[model samples]
Target chain A: MKTTPLAALHESLGARMLPFAGWEMPIQYQGIVAEHKAVRESVGIFDISHMGQFYASGNSVADWLNSLLTNDTGKLGDGEGQYTLLLNEKGGVIDDMIIYRISADEFFLVVNAARIDEDWAWFQKHCPADITLRNESDHFAGVAVQGPKAKAAWKAVFPDCDLPEKNGILEKDDWVVCRTGYTGEDGFEFFSPADQIETWFQNFLDAGAQPCGLGARDSLRLEKCFPLNGSDLNESNTPLEAGLGFFVKLDKGCDFTGSDVLQKQKSKGLKQKLVALKATGKGPPPRGGYDIALPGGEIIGQLTSGGQSPVLACGIGMAYVPIELADLGTEIEVVVRDRRYPLEVVKKPFV
Target chain B: MNVPDHLKYTESHEWIDGSEVVTVGISDHAQEELTDVVYLELPEIGRTVKKGEAIAVIESVKAANDIYAPVSGEIVEINEPLGEAPEPVNNDPFGDGWMFKIKTSNASEIDELLNADAYRQLIS
Candidate 1:
């Protein structure tokens, strides 16, 4: 199995290691609960170098980007980034991504780690003559310092590092800083050279940032009702159906892929939408694919992501429910461990 | 790593000792293997459990495991603190991490448990 620069560090710290995607990533360091609490209460550092990064540059970068993503690139100024999605002609999500416009002719695209090969191939096949795509996945490493105390911890490490002025990006030599994160918390993501990543990770730890693993990461993201790519959003899912239509630019006047189908769906209204639910009693967090039952005990939907909320002291989950039952405060039931527990539809942020 | 010399161990990885009644808990190795004990469903305090019967369920991050009864007996007491913070099993599995106490029907059943050296070899 592949390993990152921090592989030895994780082993030295007695991390529970597990195979993720293709890399042996740390599942937990001190413990999942401790790491989860640290991120929620103070600061936690995550090794995100396994995620794929790409640089798209050339004169046709703007037109090329406009042709590919569902969002309008015309509105993005230099040094700004936006969350967007790549869609197929059938309006299926190819990969949700973030686009960083570094300059008029240069942009940085960050895609999901599991979709590296597919996304790279798609960018290569669709590159316009005026633009070029460079795969920087192996050359760059990313680390995230996240939590309420993240800014303070990060400032101690890199005192000169410009605070994120806007959406998730800070400028450093050969490094890109962004205020974006999968966990619904205030934090900064540092993108730097692969070799220098270990140094940064140690620096963050020296500054008392707890080392968190994917286990804590999942709980944190689930607490925020954020969607995981494979479990929550897939090729069969559309942003409109997933309650992410705000990220789609159907009226941006750009003839991008999947625009027609998305516009048609928008006019007709969504049949299904992602909704957050909280379990009412003591029970395990609803697992993905667990049945969501109606008042009459009829199965209606299934959870895509679920976990115990360390902060909420109960089970919480996110799933696609039919539009009729998607209203906030709608009471429902979740079948977990062969038993049904009362649940209620709530707002997106379950925290 | 801290295997109390006074306590006997089972091959299934539980540790046992006798006070007025037999006290049972998972070994340190067991807790380390199942890191971050989130929720533990212990058996009823007065219920009689058979040896090797599933008496409790422990859930970690994404996995759930059945904790078998070490010796056939009536559970005299349960650890209520685990419901609020099961991490003690991860923090002090041999001491304050004791799961429950039971009145054994037969004292000879405790003799079947392995000694410290044998229990260490079983895990190693």
Candidate 2:
């Protein structure tokens, strides 16, 4: 398995390591719940170095991205980033990504770790020859500093560097700091040279940022209703069905991939929708592949992600259900291990 | 790591420490492995359970695990406090975090359980 630059540091800190997206990554350090609480209450740092990064630079970069991504890349100014999705010809999601507009001609993209190779291949097949597409996944390392105290933690570590505004990217020589995160908090993601990542991680730790892991990352993101690439999204699912229509630009006037399908889907309502659920009674926490049913026990769908919310102190999850059952306060049942758990469709950000 | 010398252990990582109405709980090593116990489904009181049968379910943030009965017995009482707050199971597995008490006629089964030294070796 592939190891991040900070693999040794995680091992030295006694982090429980596991295989994720072909990389041996830390699943937890102190504990998943404790690490999760740290991020929600104070500051926590995550080694997200295994994610993929790419550089696209050319005179036609904006137009190229505008045609490839579902979001309006043409509107992005320098130092601005947008959450976008790469869609296939059928409007199915290829991958969800963050596009950072560094300059008029230079842009950067951070994509899911597991889809790096596929995303790179897709870019190569469609990118114009004038646009220089370089996969820098091996050379860069990323660490997300997240929580209410994230800015203060970063200031302590990098006193002279200015923190970027929300969805903004600040480039300082070799380092790129972006005000973005999966956890719904005011945080920054730092991308640096691979070799210097461990030093940066140590500096953050010394500055009082608790070290978190993938387990906490999952819980934090799920609490915010952020979709996981493999579970909540796949090649067969579209952004519209995933409740991510906000990221799709159907009327951008550019003939981009999946525009026709999304435009049609927008006009006609969706058949099914991803909705957030909260357990209404005491039961086992729901998990992926668990059956979703009506009160009468008729199966409706399956959960994409589910767990006990550390912050909410209740079971929370997301599942795809019929459009009629997607309304808030709609009662449902989640079958976990042959037993049914009562749940209600509620709003997002369970915390 | 905290295997009390007075307690007996099972290969599945449960610990028992009593004569007739024995107190049962998971070992420190088991709790450490299942960090941050979030929810638990304990067997009902007076439920008859056979040895090696799954009598409870313990959930952590990442996954769920089945907790087995170490000996054939009837559950006399369960840890009521655990249903509301299970962190003690991770914090003090050998002390106030006992899961339940089983009234059993098979006192000879206690002798079959591993001692502290043997349990430590099994984990190590």
Candidate 3:
């Protein structure tokens, strides 16, 4: 398995390592609960180098990206980034990515590690001379500092470094800092040289930032009801059905590749939607692939993700159920280890 | 990491105290490995258990695990406190975190279990 530059540091900190999305990443240090609570209460840092990066240059870059992604790329100014989705011909989400506009003719795309090859090949298949795409995944290291006290810990290393207060972007030295995160916490994502990542990580840790792992990251995103690319949204699910329609710009008329099918789906309305559920009692945490049942004992949907939230102190999950049964306060059942537990469909934002 | 000298152990990582009532729970090493205990399901107090049968279920943050019986017995009492707060298993697995108390049907069954030193070598 490939290791990040902080592999030695993780081992020294007694982390439990596990293979994830093609890299050996720390699954937990101390423990998932302790690390998770630390992030919710204080600050946590994560090595996000396993994610893929792409550089798009040339004059046609913006126009080419505008036709490929679901969101409008023409609206992004220099040094701005927007969350978007690359969809298949059927309007199903192939991958979710952040498109960063580096200049009038250059852009940076950060995508899921598992979808890097597929996304790169898809981009190459439709490339024109006006756009030059290069896979730059190995050239940089990314670190995320999140939670309430994240800014304080990060400020110790680069006191003059100022992160964008909004979802825009800022350049710090040779690095890029963005004030956005998958976790529902105030944080900044730093993209710097691979050799310099460890130095800054240690600096933040020494300033009282906790070392979080994949486990805490998963829990944090789940609490925010953020859909993971493979788990909650996939090639078989449309962005509308996955509850990510807000990110898809249907009326912008950008002439994107998947615009026709997505517009049709939006007009026709979705059949199934992803909904959040809360367990009614203290029981075993629900798990993915568990069957969802109605009050009449009819199968309706299946769970995509479920766990006990250390921050919320309750059980929360995502499920794809029929639109009629997806309302808040709807009753449902989740089967765990051969026993069914009753649950209620709650409003979004499980936290 | 407490390994009670008087208790017996199993290769499956359970510890048993079989002098009178046979109290059983997971070993400290086992609990340490399954960190961040979240939810637990213990058998009813009057439930009869057979050797090697799963009597309780433990859920950590990562996954769920089954706790098997060390000897054939009837459960007499259970640590209900774990249902409210399961982190004690991570804090003190051998003492306050003991799972259940079982009244053994056959006292001779304890002889087949491994002692403290034997259990230490088994885990090692």
Q: Which candidate is the best by lDDT?
A: 2
Q: Order the candidates by TM-score, highest first — what do you get?
A: 2, 3, 1
Candidate 1 local lDDT, A1-351, one digit each (tens): 768778888888888889998898998888787898999999999988888899999987977898889888888888888889998888888889888888889998888888899999988998877788899899888888888888888789889765765464656778878878877777878878888888888888999899998888999998887778887888877888877877888777777888888888888988888888998777766677888899767898788888777778677888888888889999988886667888888887877
Off by over 4 Å in 1: A168-171, B18-23, B32-36, B43-55, B71-112, B121-124
Clashing pairs for predicted structure model 3, backbone only: none
Tell me the whole-model lDDT of each prediction, alpha carbons only. Answer: 0.84, 0.91, 0.84
Q: Model 3 over residues A1-351: C-alpha lDDT tens digits? A: 778878888899888899999899988888887777787889888888788888899987887888888888778888888999999998888899988887889988888878888999999998986678889788778888888988887677778766666566776677777777778888878778788888878888898888988988998889889888888888888888988888888777677767788788778888888999898987788877788898658777788888888877777899988999888888998877767888898888987
Model 2 per-residue lDDT tens digits across residues A11-35: 8998999999999999999998899
| Whole-structure CA lDDT of model 1 | 0.84
Query: Is candidate 1 or 2 superior in lDDT?
Result: 2
Docking tier of model 1: it is: acceptable
**Candidate 2 Cα RMSD (Å):** 1.8
In the range B48-86, model 3's lDDT, one tens digit per residue, is 999889888999878889999888888999999998888
TM-score of chain A for the candidates in order shown: 0.95, 0.98, 0.96
Docking class of 2: medium
User: Order of candidates by lDDT, top first?
Assistant: 2, 3, 1
- Off by more than 4 A, model 3: A171-174, B45-48, B105-109, B121-124
The candidate that wins on TM-score is: 2
